[model samples]
Target: MKSLDIMIVDTPYCFAPEKLRKLLKWFFLAYIQTLT
Candidate 1:
């Protein structure tokens, strides 16, 4: 979690609503893939 926070802070563009949404969607997909 700390690493994730640092990552977000480092990537300022993630604050943009559209980019954040896409990032979250991509993260969710990656998480699901790991579960499978």
Candidate 2:
């Protein structure tokens, strides 16, 4: 997660933060569902 944070900071131009955040939120939700 630290690495991902660094990557996000390093590549702000590559992906809009708001969109990336929404995408990450969806992915995290899916991951949680799978875990259960």
Candidate 3:
């Protein structure tokens, strides 16, 4: 949890809404791939 929090904060998109949306889209895609 701590590492995840750190990662999010360290992200260049942390304060950018457009980049954040793209980030979440890719994140979900990666997560779905893992499940498959």
Candidate 2 lDDT, 1-36, residue by residue in tens: 456546545665446688777776676576568668
Q: Residue 10 error for model 2, in Å? A: 10
The Cα local distance difference test for each model comes to 0.66, 0.64, 0.66
Candidate 3 residue-wise lDDT, 1-36, digit = tens:
356546655776646689676876687577668678
lDDT of 2: 0.64
On the 0 to 100 scale, the lDDT of residue 20 in model 1 is: 85
Off by over 4 Å in 3: 1-16
Model 1 residue pairs with clashes: none
- Over the stretch 1-36, how does candidate 1's per-residue lDDT look in tens digits? 456556655665546689686886687577668779
> RMSD of model 2, in Å?
5.2
Q: What lDDT is reached at residue 5 by model 1?
A: 50
What is the lDDT, from 0 to 100, of the residue 11 in candidate 1?
Answer: 65
TM-score rank order: 2, 1, 3
